[model samples]
Target chain A: MMCYIYDGSFEGLLTAIYETYYRKEHPNKILSITDYEKSFLYKDVFIDTDPNKSDKVYNSIKTKISNQTLKHVFHAFVSENEDSGTWIYNYLRLGWKVGKKLDLHLTDDRVLAIHNITRKVSREIHYMQGLLRFRKIKNDVFYAPFEPQFNIVGLLASHFANRMSDQNWIIHDVKRDIGVLYNQEEWVITNINLKGDITFAEDEEFYQKLWKEYFKNIAIKNRINPKLQKSNMPMKYWKYLIEKN
Target chain B: MEILDKLKILADAAKYDVSCSSSGSSRKNKKGGLGNSHISGICHSWSDDGRCISLLKILFTNYCIYDCAYCVNRSSNDIPRAMFSPEEMVNLTVNFYRRNYIEGLFLSSAIYKSPSYTMELLLKTVKTLREKNFNGYIHLKAIPGADLNIMREAGKHVDRMSVNIELPSNNGLKLLAPQKSKEHIIKPMGLISSKIVENVSERKLYKNSDKFVPAGQSTQLIVGATPDKDLNILTLSESLYERFNLKRVYYSAYVPVSKHPNLPQISTPPLLREHRLYQADWLLRFYGFKSQELLDSKNPNFDIHFDPKCNWAIRNLHLFPVEINRADYEMLLRIPGIGIKSAKKIISARRVGPINYDNLKKIGAVLKRAKYFITCQGKYYGETKFNEDNIKNSLLANSSDKLNITQGEQLSLFSLYPNLLPLPDILTKITGEL
Candidate 1:
């Protein structure tokens, strides 16, 4: 059985799919570089990153299937789940067979699994848009540090660009070590490290105190349900939140 | 005074007024504007009580002129007082919005000096936010008896405005809040409703005329405070929605903060009762159930054990055993535990072919409760016959109690065990009756 190995990038994964169709040979499984296995009987076919092949697959999906379907597949790719490769493969396979209306078949497990991952990623992005608290730094640029469970650092750029159009801001995902920096005109992605001696705005402490006070006082003491708070705002995001901190 | 102290006092005073919706409008951010309103709204945080903290809910002041027996901020009560200037309010809103800490501002105020005076301050704050090009959502409370012109002008700059009818009945208002009258409250609501209608027709012709409360209006009714039954409250809400074209009717379970003679003899707010009222209200708004349909004169209040939809479905059991694949959207909605989302899913899925029990589960329908009311193609999967007590006991047996309702008179609000009742879960999901 042949095992197709890609470079752990979305484009590389697409190129592998292109090769599977081009060679008319089905692999036993598709895997990324990090999850490589060494064995006796497994034939390893390394997939080189080809932009032309990836673009062909991308355009074919937008034309042959649906653009909305492509978005769901891309969102599931960034979900970084262990079952993502197989489920997305099955989803695309079913999507191509059912034409544009594949999304309506909720009974299909592959389609259901892909939608679930897409929901998780989108939910995380939406929650981050609310939970991310920005603090002004020395250069008058706003910086927020968070550690989301999913790799959605690049997904939040367009939302903040539309909302905070007048200010320069940075949203840093500490776990992945990458961040998006926006300067009102455009946004750039870079690997940023800020655990060392990050400076704050002069009145940053004062605002933080006020926000904590508001969060505490807004709760009805007669109706204190700590379990509910924990369910909505889980403890994983607590250390980065201003009030939870 | 320090800003932290002011926030503590104002936010503490404002906690009892439970209207935390940040939805209904989709105002885009102008090129120079600082923020925009999302169509379905966004929730920033959840308080310890499981209530959503969407907007920056705070009163402009805690000082008041009227003495209401049930209120903590009445003239007789000696609570610490603080107020924010219009400019300070604008600054706080803009900064918090930029930091993504809130959806917008929910600015309510006490009647300092007079109702008009308090409304003028709220109007100034919202107008300044608009003039400064901060396009975030703002839900301003229109003080009853405020000048009509000032209220209309305030509506121009804000997304939503609510004139709370705190007490449902006239006698309750007279006994508890002698300074307030039912007539004074409804006057502003009527005017705002007419103005909203006028603005819609005018904008249709004029194209770019400034919007007047583009998200429309809503009001709140404090439940469990007086002896009014759920039927009276639901009937009033039904009329409000029909007469005023109201966007929503919020039900805040009365949290007993003051010791008063006229109030009910309860130490804790009736959480289950309040939850039941919200469930019935959802049926009225979304499920197309009328006030008379959910309850009758024989039973003025909703059933404490079962939800309103479940109760109604059980009573009309002849309509049950509906074929999931063949049922129309409205017929599917009548089945217990099937919400608008799952109903739409069933409709779309059936178009491809026949559906079965596994497909129903995949569509996110609450199969435990829906099983008793529906059949898949030709076969029924329900355990109990068409009987009320049997279905109710089975539903209770199946649920894991999402809410922490407990037993006895102490009525602890912090219990983790779920007799489990908070219908619709969140306030903004009021459109989804399930």
Candidate 2:
């Protein structure tokens, strides 16, 4: 049995995928370097990431299969699920045969696996877009820190970049120890380790107090349903919510 | 008063006006704008009532000149009064918006001094937001009896506008809110509708033309406040959708906040009835069901035991046993427990291959109720006979465990029956889809 392993970066995974197609080898598992364990039973192949090979694979997925399929593969890769690499490999192999009709084959198990993972990632992206609370910090930069289940800081930053075009902002995925730093012009995802307490700007407490007051008063006393509130805004997300605190 | 005290009073007063959606507008970010509106709305948080906290829903003021019997802020009731200056309101919106506490502002107001005066105040606040390049979603209230020119100008500055037709029936309006006339409310709605139509065509001719209420308009109707039946309300809603082309009609259950001779002396809000109305409203908008078909003179209210679609399907059993694969999208939508989402999935899945019972479930169809109404490849899955009574009993047995209603008790022959079933109170939480 052969096992393919690469660095956890998206481009490294794409490069490994290109090699599998080029070499015509069906590996048992495709894993990231961090997730890979040393095994004597299977021959391990460490893939070196080549930008040219990865770009070829990226363009082929876009031009041959579909743009949406590319999005699925990228999102599923970033989901950080252990089996996601194998799922994306199988999905793209099938997608290469079916072309743009790949998503329509929802009944196929290989397609369904990718579909479910992408859906989970996209759901987190949508939720983080709304639930992320930004605190005004020193130098007028709006800083929002969240511990989302999926590694979706890049997607969330893009959404906010368009919505808040004039302001400088940073969205930190605290769990992953990475963040997207956005100036007025553009955004870039980079490794960031934030420690200690963040100092908030002046009047931050005033607005937060007002928001808490509004959140408290807006609920009808007669229609208080804590169960419903918990379901919609689950306990996992309450750690950083200003109103929940 | 300080901003903290004023926010508490104004937000408490504004809680009853439940038009909670921040959707339908796609105002993009400008070169140097503070915010932009998403095409699909986002909910920031859910309150204790499980309602979406999409916007910073607050009233410009709690002071009112008119005394409406159903209102907490009515003049006769001496509630704590407060108001926000235009600059104060703008600052709160910008600061709240920057901190991601809200999508935008929902600036509603009680009739302070006069309708025109209140309308001008709303216009001023939104105009300042626009001037600051704040492109966030703004849902402004159009004060009835306000000057047309001011309201028209206000429409250009906000993403959406709404006028609450508080009572469904004109008689209910006259008896409870005597100060408000039917024409005063309807006139602004009519004007906004026409202006939206005008804006659409103008933008088509000139791409850079100014947008008027780009998210369109919506309205709220208070349920259980007056003796208005579901039929009247649904009919009014249908016409509002057809004639005015409004985006949505929100139904807020009367919470019994005030004491009045005209109001029902109920301790609790009629949440179940409100839930049924919302279900029926969904049928009208998406399921291709009509107001007349859902109810008539013979049956004016929904059955408390079953949802509207299930109740309608049981009443008309002849339409059941619909072939799952062969049925068109419209017929698929009429089946019980098959929502618009599931119906669309079935259609798309059919193109790939023939679907079985398992495939239907995987497609997100609620087969618990749909199993009775549909057939898979010429075989019916329902255990009971195809007759209305058998299927109805089976469905009752299925739902009675959840609702805690007595299983075998016969429904009363009288039309106006009490809410015997004690469904959970969370059922009244207004879903964001509406």
Candidate 3:
């Protein structure tokens, strides 16, 4: 009975998985250091994040099990679910035994657990890609502030980078206090804080007013269903949406 | 007029044209490009009426030369008119795209001077967006009777082009819209359809050949406007998909905005019927069901209680109780509750091991609807006996009444402003169908 703990970073989780294999210890639980609580039932082992070890495990999963399973692991890590660490650890344990045929075993509870979390993460990414409303701020930069359920700021960088290739933009995850900043050519994720005071560029309020007006008139007044609207764009996401606000 | 006033009148006028999808084109961003098109189409917002606002759907102008009885923008109607200059349209599209407020522009218009002249302005707007290195999705409405050379040239600049065949049947068209001949509408559709076919082969030969309507063509048909049956609409849509290779056919419920002698005087839009038609459309495109299979001369309308697939399955009870593990992919799709995603999951899961009743749910099968139609591991899980009436009753007992036909009628436009409605001749349009 061993409990493995690592830092909250994705690389740290992979390094923890590597330790379980190298030390030949069966993990009773795998958790991040932030999620760990004192328990007398098992001995805790703090696994330090080593890039070399993490890369080795990452490449092995891509080659041994399948590239798709590797993506599932990464997405599960990004989901930030409380039990995601344990689920990914168990899923990989089974995936290592079955090799490339692991994803076909959908009925397996561990595989299903990992698959479900990955779906949640990807679904949030897709939703945020659409729901993120950018406001023009100083310096002709497009700034969007959102509070997504999952840590998906990094995942959205490449998408917006390719879509808005000629403009400078910043996608801020307000809850996480991190942003993906994109120049004309490339993007990088870094810590940022707006402190809730954002100066709108000239004509920004005009366009926002126009958008709100368009939103109101575009709906078929004959078919006003708040339930359907709430289902598609939930109430929680209305905090930062320009039209909703 | 100010831009704000123009946007309001134009967007309000264009709301009835209900094709807002910005999908199917994967135009990549070139060097120094401002935007790119998403293949799956991203919806930026849902309007209060619960429809997706993907593209910035608006009309180039709301002025028309021909009067149509079913249209709000009929030349005879006393509505506010507005038009966007080519530069104004280009500015709105770029700013909206940059702000992530929309995927692209769904540019439609009422015919102003003439068809060819109107199309030329629409073409100029899209061309300016392209010249500015904007790679975002652009859906341009091809004015029917527009010159073929202008329409063909417009196709090369836009992602998709559509000429609305608003009325489903030619007879309906003649009676409701006297000016629009069926030939005038079909001619442009045929030209655009053939050019899209030509572009496919040309692209194969020269990779750099510009794509023509790369997202493919789509059209909208207003339901409940005329006395056209679901059979006529479905059959017409089937031919459009087969002949023109249309990517989609949108069905909008007729929202009564004008009092016309030929149009129906319904108090509310037939939302439930429109929903059922869309469901049936999905079946024809993806579920492999033909129009003739869903309806016959005896039954020209869908059941108000059951969906098209469930209704079909009940009438043909011999096809029920399909063995889940042994059923082919197409047969799995034929079952009431199994969809394309679930069918694919079943096939992939069966390769690993045989599926049972428990695994069917995790594979995404809706057991409440599928239980009566399938058997897992040779075991039946349905509550009722293996008969048509029993199965339908059991299914009905478990179903929710959310999509009741009588719903959505209480909140009518006439209900809000009682003084504005013409109530005396309401009986002139009720055939008691649908």
Among the numbered candidates, top DockQ falls to 2
Candidate with better DockQ, 1 vs 3: 3
Kindly report which residue pairs in candidate 2 clash with one another.
Answer: none
Worst 10 residues of 2 chain B by lDDT: B413-422
lDDT of 3 by residue, B277-385 (tens): 8889989999999999999888988876788999999999987789999999999998998899899999988998999998988878999999999888998999789
Candidate DockQ values, in order, are 0.60, 0.81, 0.62
Write the residue-wise lDDT of candidate 1 on A174-205 in tens digits.
88889999988999999997667789889778
lDDT of each: 0.83, 0.88, 0.87
Best by TM-score: 2
TM-score of 1: 0.94
The CAPRI-style docking tier of model 2 reads high
lDDT by residue for model 1 (B294-407), tens: 988898888766788888888888788899988888888888889988998888777766899988898899998899999897898887766777877888888655544445
lDDT of 3 by residue, A125-170 (tens): 8778788999999889999989998888999999999998888999
Clash pairs detected, candidate 3: none
lDDT leader: 2
Runs of candidate 3 with Cα error greater than 4 angstroms are B403-434
Query: What is each model's TM-score for chain A?
Result: 0.95, 0.96, 0.97
What's the residue-level lDDT of B101 in candidate 1?
Answer: 84
Error of 3 at B250 (Å): 0.5
